[model samples]
Target: MKKIGLIVNPIAGMGGSVGLKGTDGGIYKKALKLGAKTVTPKRTKELLSYIKNRNEINLVVAPGKMGEAYVREFNIAFKLIGQVPEETSAEDTRRIIGEMLNGGIELLVFVGGDGTARDVYDAVGSKIPVVAVPSGVKVFSSVFAVSARAAAEIVDAFIEGTNLTEEEVLDIDENAFRDNRLASKLYGYLMVPNVKKLLQAGKEASSMGKSSVDSKGEIARYIVENMDKETLCLLGPGTTLKAITDDMGLPKTLLGVDAVYNNRLVGKDLNEKGILRLLKKYKSKKIIVTPIGGNGFIFGRGSKQFTPEVIRLVGRGNIIIVGAYGKVSKLDCLRVDTGDFEIDKLLSGHIKVIVGKKEEMVMEVRC
Candidate 1:
């Protein structure tokens, strides 16, 4: 049997919607206390659902929520690799990867974000190529495939003898990130089955220079001038959208969803349920979101608070996308992986994104 290693970070993205930034260290407990749910199992199952040649491979997985729980739900049989603790850690990821490599697993598949990528690199280096499923709050690494289905495609190509190439393993300190500071570093690289548009580029930090700031100012001016007084505006996180509130002289959360009405900040740092509650109170609503710098993700990266139900309530036409020219130009296309196929479809296609003052461009939205 063709042996493949599968590992899942059970609490990878739990901190995102809860506005905790990441589940690294004891923050996972805080995320749980905030009612954050497991994200990787669902993503893992989505990746598994895309595999048509499952019978051709034997998966080696970690125990419990790490890997076995989702794998067990499927018909495919897998080998259990390690003993998992009730509370898993980065060391568990490192240890499980070592076990997977020692067992002669050909391809390594992990469901996680940047921190998980760092663990995989630390464990095995470039010994085996990896296919990463994007499932964390900080998916700023190039090692991951663009989406769950794309990861399955990469793995299938690997089994078919496709050539592997190096992809960057990038990560940031979660503690630093939660403090409103970005400190990204290149940990190493991972070999991956490379296919065009299948892999994502490493997250690029937005330019803090005058030119980028000027462009954001222009875009912010345009949005504020076009705002309707009767509409309740839900603003997603990022420096770009924060610029809007900055120009309006309103308080804005730099990393969490906030609400505005009548040119004033109404709600701050809202969760999914909090957003839903506002939607119920307001009859006219709109969602203003900006794309992640390098990934071009308008949803499913940091702003999981804009859940599918929230998007549906806001309606597709009511959603506004904004991006700086420097940021949007680096991306191949905009992406949205809302974890709901129907909702993704609702968001897919050409989207008009505001780039500057009275400047908009139509960009393709890929799922």
Candidate 2:
């Protein structure tokens, strides 16, 4: 029988939406005291639903509360082979993944947000095929399904002899917390179903970069020259691309991505809704963004302004990647991460991003 691994971070995303930021360390203690119920452990129903009908795959579990509870809730018979650490952190998650790899499991399906992804990445190192069911507050990496039901659908596809693909998973800055600082770390990679569209976690992808002084004055000039007063130009976060905000003579929210049109500020630090609001106010919209060096993720870090709905409305053609010529030429391929997997897949194509007018360079971008 084919073996499938199941594990759960019971308190993974409990603090989200409740204004607690994330559940980590003793934060859950504070949450319980704050009159908050531990939210459903991330992605419980979704992974199980995938196995509800099929008898082809046998499930391998971590331990009692760790992995067994989930399999039992699904009424699926599973063999508990590894012990789950009671007072566990992300490292424990990695340990369980390592155990599963040794067991030769066919697939590794996990639940949680970016933290969980990091654990799996650390343990598996891109050799295992994995999928994540969305159960966290902010899913930013391309490692999860859109919903619990969608995850079930993906598992069903796999069981029915569908092909899967190896996809890169990313890590996030746990120490950064809610300080409005985005410092991410790359753990490793994983494989998932071959579906082109999937929802990633609202993770703070732990990617970092050097604080270099890059003069974006020329790129800013180009944007200002090309922008039509009638069209809306959505400016994303990061010090490099934000120069457009200054050239437009509008005060930039250093922490947030904003929108400008007809020489006026329409939105500030916009999320999916805020960007869509700006789009509705002005139908013709253009999105401007820049990728952090060492990590090619285009969206989902500090810039939630260009949300999935907004990107869809504005369309990919209007999206622009602005950076120095040196920054632009360093990439072999452009990465797509809009916090929405389906939309990210929609943008899966190769394109040349021209950073400055005088300095011409070509970079391959995959959506």
Candidate 3:
């Protein structure tokens, strides 16, 4: 059987719903105090559940909540690699992955986001191929699969014999991220199964070229012209969406959710609780969002504040998608991974995107 290793960063995505942006350093404790829950467990279980070639491989997993907790539920053969304390940290992730590598694992499957990807790159480098499950808040790295199910597929492909390719691992500054600045640099690369269709594209910085700027202005003008003054508009994060607020002469959180009512700034940098409170007060609500430039994700990437409940309350009909032609044209299709399969299914299908003034494109939304 092909030997595979599994590692889970238990505290990876605890900060997303609470508006902490990332769980790096000591921010995980703050996220816990704010009622953030463990996100990697469900993601690990989903990845294990969807792996069709379970019997064809043996798993070497880290002990406790880091890995063993979820693998025990499955019938696959696995062995514990290293011990971890009750409260796990990035050091635990790095140390355990090193042990797994020394144990001669042919491939590794890790569940977490950008930080976790960096840890894996530090441990594994280009030694063996890996399948990265996207479970963390800022999953901007191209090394990750689009979703857990996709990660499972990548694993099966690796076991079935696929070529390996190097994917980038990005280092994101959590402190700068919380302060409304996206500071990132290329940390390193990890070898992954070359299943191009299953992998996600790395986040591309917004273009500032003349054509791109003009396109954004046209989109902002068109949205403002057609906006309903009586509706409460929840604007998702992105410079493209921020252009709309700038056009209205209102401030916006560059990387956080904001609320607008009758062209007035009602809320800024809203968390899940804050968003729910606003949804309760207003009956007529609409959500304006722009997809990530390269990844084409409208939800479940940068803005986790737009939870499944929030999307349900806003309803599918009230969601407005806006992007510049330069960005939308490069994407194959739009995607959404709300962590709830029902909500993802609800969002999948054909949707209209406003690219410029009186210009719209019908794009398919894939779950």
Candidate 4:
């Protein structure tokens, strides 16, 4: 049997819905204080359900909430590897990985965001391929699959002898990010299954050329001009969407979702509960978002504040996607990983994307 290493970061993604941006450092306590919940368990469960060759694989997992708890529920043949403390740390991750590697795990599949990837990279480097399931607040790393289900597809391909490629392990300093500055750097590389369309590309920094700026302004103009007075607008994160707020002279959170109504900022850095409250107050609403450059993700990338519930409440017709011409041209299609299979299916189709003030194009969105 092909041996596989499975590890879960129990606290991954806890800060997303609470507007903490990430759970790194002492921010995890702040996230819990804001009523953040565990998302990694549910995410890992979804990924394991899609494994078709479970009989051919032996999963070596860590103890308790780290790995064995979820693996046991799935009935997949797994061996418990190591003990985990009540509160886990990066040291635990590295130690568990070392044990798994010594046990001859062929491929290591982990569930977390950029931080977990860095830990895995430090332990294994490119010695064995890895499949990362996105369960953290900011999954800017290319080492992760676009979604949990996609991670399963990549694992199946790995068992089928698919070729592997070295993908960059990149992460940002969350402290700098929370301070309204982006400081992304390449940490290392990991060998990953080269499954086209199943894996996501690394996030690219926004190009600040004059034309890019001009295009954002045009797109912003179009959205503002077409705004319905009675509707509440949920502006997602990214500089492209920030342009709209800039044109309206409204303050915006660079990495959190904001709410606008009648060309005014209603709420900034809202959480899931905050959004639902706003949705209840406004009968008419729309969500305006821009794709993450090089990744083509309009939703389910870094902004988990626009949860599946928020998307369903707004409805698909009320969703407006905008992107700069340069960014849109570089992408094959847009992607979404909302963790809701039904919702994902509902969103999979050709949709209209506004690229400029008067320029709109039809593009396909894959789940």
Candidate 5:
């Protein structure tokens, strides 16, 4: 029997509201602001149905939302190697990868977005062949399947000895993201190696990322409306945040994050440490960021401008998230990660990032 590893990023699409763009990490709050819904059980059910009768494949799955519950729903017995923590992060995904690698699964199937792909890349890299389900906002990479049912087709083909190809994995600019900048670095390619009868690995797929242009415009209007005195608004990348700068009719970096104060660019792509220097003048501050679709990472991958010190200086409560509906529903819920373990903890536990006035959103994080 061929071994396969399955993982589902449960909250992968929760950032599709308020124009934050992606919901992987920093933008889930925007999803809440825009009234987005989760795409969970339905997507899960689809996968379960396809794999229900397969016998040539041995399924090794991560527990709960990862695959266990869905497997049971389809009555497909699977080996449970690990359980996702009640508040699981991409860390859990990596842990599962370790297990899959140790067990030497032939193929890895991931469910989520670009951020999720990055996580998978970090864990498995080019060691094995992988195919992803396009369940996130912006799937900029080339390792994904065409559609939900299409994923099943790939699996079937792989089992039948189809050949897959190598794909390029992108390294995202997290620091620029907090300031509303978008610069993607091409890390390299991992060859999945075409199999004779296995399902053919797909090419780059479409993205659910909303145009941040209008959202940034709206945010700029809000900043202008509220920027009477000394409040500083730190901006992050993506079209949404760029909208704010655009509304001001100023050129903003689409790939890097920036800060807006008094209707002006204060800083650009400031990391956690960089924000420390800028924080000296601004007592009242606001940090803006887009969410990563699927992976739900708030800080590690994108929005590196809002560093731990910056978050502390600005206060997590003062952070504002932005996104549109298309970005949020990519994942069933929302997610966050700052890269720093202790900071992840400090930022965890019912943190309230500003989504809007009286129109705020909340997330339950495990730091």
Candidate 6:
């Protein structure tokens, strides 16, 4: 049987819903104080449950909440690799992974976001292929699978013998991210099963070229012209959405959710609680969003503040997606992974995206 290693970063995504962009460094403590809950447990369980070839492999997992807690629920046989304290850190992730490698694991399946990906790269490098489950806040790295179910599929493909390819691991600055700036750099690469359809494309920065800028302007103009003055508009992050706020001469949090009413900036850098409060205050509400350039994710990637609760309140009919033609034309389809299977299913299907002035494209939203 193929020996696969599993590692989970227990506190990886605690900061997303609370408006802290990432959980790196000491931000997880802040997330806890703000009532953030553990996100990786559900994600880890989902990945384990979806692996169709569970009987074909022997599992090696980290101790406690890191890995063993979830694997024990499944019928699969697995051994504990390393011990961890109540409060786990990045060092624990890297150290345990090293032990798993030394124990002769054929492949590693890690559940976390970009920070956890970097830890995996540091521990294994190109030594063993991995299936990265997207459970963290800033999962902008290309090394991750599109979703938990997709990660399971990648594992099955690896067991059945698929070619391996190197995917980039992005290093994002959490401090800068919380301050309304996206500072990211290519940190390293990890070898993954070359399941192109199941893997997510890495996040691409917005283009500043003349044509791209003009297209964004066109989209922004159309949205601003059609906006309802009586409706409370919740604007998601990205330059395209920023253009809409720019058109009205209102300030926007470049990487956080904001609220607008009557073309006024009512709220800036709103968290889940803040968003819910605004949703309650305003009767007529709508959400305006732009997909990540390469991954084509309208939610569940960068803007986690638009939690499932917020989305349900806004409803599907009130959501407006906008993208520039230069970017939208290349994407196969849009995607969403809100961590709630029900919400994801509710968002899947065909949707309209405003590409330019009076121009719209019908794109399918895949969960």
Task: Mark the 10 consecutive residues where model 4 has the least summed lDDT.
Answer: 174-183
lDDT-wise, the better of 3 and 4 is 3
RMSD of each: 1.4, 7.5, 0.8, 1.1, 13.4, 0.9
Instruction: List the candidate 4 regions with Cα displacement exceeding 4 Å.
Output: none
Any idea what lDDT model 1 has? 0.88
Angstrom error of the Cα, residue 73, model 4: value is 2.2
Per-model TM-score, in order, reads 0.96, 0.58, 0.99, 0.98, 0.52, 0.98
- Steric clashes per prediction: 0, 16, 0, 0, 76, 0
- Tell me the tens digit of each residue's lDDT in model 3 across 1-367: 8999999999988898988899999999999999999899999999999999999989999999998999998989999888899998888998998999899999999999999999999999999999999989999999999999899999999999999999999999989999999989999999999999889999999998999988998899889988999999999999998999999999999999999999899999998999999999998999999999999999999999999999999999999999999999999999998788899999999999999898898999998
Quality of model 3 by C-alpha lDDT: 0.93
Encode model 1's per-residue lDDT on 93-126: one tens digit a residue: 9999998999999998999988888999999798
Can you tell me which runs of candidate 6 are displaced by over 4 Å? none
lDDT-best of 1 and 6: 6
Score candidate 2 by TM-score against the native: 0.58
lDDT minimum window of 10 residues, candidate 2: 202-211
Q: Which is the better candidate, 2 or 6, if ranked by lDDT?
A: 6
The list of candidate 5 runs beyond 4 A from truth reads 26-35, 51-53, 174-180, 193-367
Q: What does candidate 5's lDDT look like per residue over 206-304, in tens digits? A: 152344334335555765566544777777666666666777776766755567777677776454444666788777877777665544445533344
- Better by lDDT, candidate 2 or 1: 1
lDDT tens digits, residue span 207-304, model 4: 99999999999998888888897899999898988999998999889888999998778898899989999999999999999889989888887788
